[model samples]
Target: MIEVSKGIYWVGAIDWEIRDFHGYATPKGTTYNAYLIVDEKVALVDTVKEPFRDELLSRVGEIVDPAKIDYVIVNHLERDHFGSFAQVMDVAKNAKVYASGRGKKGIEEVYGERWDVTAVKTGDTLGLGKRTLRFVETPMLHWPDSMFTYVEPDRVLISSDAFGQHVAGSQRFDREADPHALMEDAKTYYANILMPFGTLIQGLLAKVPSLNLAPEIIAPDHGLIWTKPGTIIDAYGRWSKFEARDKVVIAYDTMWESTGKMAHLIARGAIDGGVEVKLFHLRKSPYSEAVTEIQDAKAFIIGSPTLNNGLFPTVGGFLYYLKGLKPKHKIATAFGSYGWMGGAVKEIVARLKEMELELAEPALDLRYPVTKQQEQECIEFGRKIAKQVKEAKQ
Candidate 1:
């Protein structure tokens, strides 16, 4: 945890979660987040999970007298929110804990320890000396315990997890590092981390707009703080809308590299036309993650050499995942390295149809040991997509 602003600091844990990169079904390296405050009356916004309770306390101790902290506001009750709850109060005995009415119930379930917890509803306001914090109940903004706390005067939004990336580090603000990687991480965070609550997210977007609240800085519980504000808010709005990128996502599962050759050719063409592309070898990529990469691509293309009388088994899995996502504003095509058994291309095309992807004209399917003509066809396919990309942009 590090301080990013005067009287403000990040108390979140770096994701050292084992296999975090692989994902949740597997061992997920997750960021256990928390925050601290130093106002006229010191307060701590949230606490880390239990394993880092002591660390949370020490961080809070860095600025002021923990005992003098007037409040410990609980944002959400996933142990991540209150794992350090007890230890924090152990140090700040006289502090008042604030949370939503339902959020308080959650805190109590594990709060077995005694403490002063005040439950407030929407529109509740807390006076923290020179600054005022407004609590906005954002139920199901991913979780029931979820809420958005806005600190007026400073124009800071202490959002727990929202607009946050699953970044692992002690860097408190984004300006300190590379913006591109962090932004991608933030996008992946939205697509994968917050995927399940789309409707609620849309509602939050509508509601927050009515508040006319645009923070100059958005301080989330995880990842770097947004000192430049709209950089992340704009991103959140675009991502939540499932905006499509003018790029192609190439997913392929090749039996003997023939289908892979076709995929490479198509990618070259798309790149030549200035369409960005992400190539994921299905055998080497997880279906769940591939779906994420495909989420916003302007086009999706899959290739699989015939196997078991149909598309490769992995290609089928990827298709199923894509179908569940029901992506929008995308074109789809099928290509493959087929031998005597050329059914894979047809099967993939049919599956893509089931996913509701608008078909791009003339799906390409190549036979084993492509001749010069086949490679040229691949380049043509790329060039076609590139043209479409530019036309779409226009």
Candidate 2:
């Protein structure tokens, strides 16, 4: 067990083999992190998934008996974080449960009211002799019941899900992990899970500074803890604002080689026009990974071949996922190939429009095998888009 503070130990389990999390790919696995603080009243920050309850209990047992636990904090009511709450309370029967008002209601809705949970609001503090535990409500920072627990004296914020990554490893802090990979996972997490709540995140960030809570460390529910809180706080500020770079992402799926060839030619034109680009075959690449690329890109170009009267199933799935993510301040366009009925490009265009992205151009479609003239047209279309991206106001 890693000691984050003098009296606080990380008592969480790492899922080394989990390949997927809530439908998102978790190739690197993840950690269901919880913290144990030994003060006048022993407090548990959070708990693990239901399957990992034994692991959490074992870790907590190393420092103190489970019966000694006096308080259990529920930062978020999601199953991943709250699945083992019942088990913890069952063992530490004397421990009083604490959660935000909404969190308490959500927990009751899911697990019934066998145990009495004290509902707290923003700015509420619980004294534990030497240190103070303060609650901050963060609704829709991914979930309505999400809240942050600030442990004073230690100056640590037990941030629930915010500023977290799906990384399972021996390291317990961001400094111990590969910074590049950790940041990449953090970006992917933000893109897939938290992008839709951009406004709420921004509001949370602005609210934190005014509270004057200078957190020295940020302990999140997943991934390594952030010892240097400034790094992640700065990142959240930028990401919450939907700040993007001068890059384009071209995502597409192909049946034969027609649509694939167009994707390559278009990528080539964008490169020749001095615009940074990322190209991914949706079926080959994880949709979550593509969403990560799209997060900070100024433009997205989609290509798919028509199947029956609609988009390719893989393409449709990717678009559906991307649309739900609600990427903002992006320009989009579509290109595809069809055999008899040309409908894929139109459908892709409509999906991008539904996402509220600025339509960079009308959809481009080709019948059967793409001709040399059509390839050239695709190239010009890419160049035109590059010009638009270059001229876009930062």
Candidate 3:
């Protein structure tokens, strides 16, 4: 186990083989992080997933006997963070289990009454000799039972999932990770898991200072521990506000080559209009990646061929995921080619409207193979959206 501070250690497990978390692709895998704080009465902050329970015990065992742990604090009840709760309770038999009220109920519902679990709320403090850990309820910052534990003197915030990435490696601190790689994973994590909780995050950030919880280190349940918490806190602030770069994303799926041509032509138009563009083929690109792009870009330009009088499956599925993620303050437009029916463009527009993104340009629904005029129109449509995005930026 690595010592994170004077008396605290990292006793977590790293999963180097995990390629996907639930449905979101985690090509870089992740870490199920838990902390071990040794004071007069030792406290264990969270636990790893079921499969990594052994790893966690091994790390903790290197420092102190598992049986010596006095309190086991659960910040979240999500399976990844608490799947090994049973094993922990069994090993640390004398330790008092603590969780948020909702977290306690959820844990009991999932695992039954095998262990004594105490419910805690915001402002609750658990004293351990010279050190004290304060709980801050952050419900729906991703999950209803989510919370954060602040360790005083050391100034460490054991953030459940917030400020986490999906990077699995020996580098335990954000200072050790590649800035670009860390940011990419962070953005993907936020887009896939926490984007829906933007409003809650904003509220939480505003209240942090008033609560007097300025952490020097942010130890999340996954990925690298943020040694410089201010960097991540600033990032969260900007992302929660739904800030965007001056760029356009042309996401599409083509039945033949017609819609594909339109996507490229539109991308060219956006470039000529002086804004950056990202063209993604839905079939070739993963939704996780596309969502990351949507998280930053100012405009969304979609193209999809009609199938069964509706959007193509790939495009339709993407819209569903995007809508759930709730990316905001973007301008959107649609384009597509059709044979017998031309509902793809219209359906795409409807989905964009549901997301509440501004309509930057008119839809460009065309016939079978894009003609010269339609190609030109696609370019003009791109240019129109680019201009709109630029204007929004100003």
Residue 118 alpha-carbon offset, candidate 1, angstroms: 4.6
Model 3 sits at a Cα RMSD from the real structure of 1.1
**For every candidate, C-alpha RMSD to the true structure in Å:** 4.0, 1.1, 1.1
lDDT of 3 by residue, 189-217 (tens): 99899998889999999999787898989
Comparing 1 and 2 on lDDT, the stronger one:
2
TM-score preference between candidates 1 and 2, better one: 2
Off by over 4 Å in 2: none
In candidate 2, what are the lDDT values of residues 213-248, reduced to their tens digit?
A: 789999999998999888888887788777888888
Clashing pairs in 3: none
- Model 1 Cα shift for residue 296 (angstroms): 4.7
State each candidate's clash count: 3, 0, 0
User: Model 2: number of clashes?
Assistant: 0
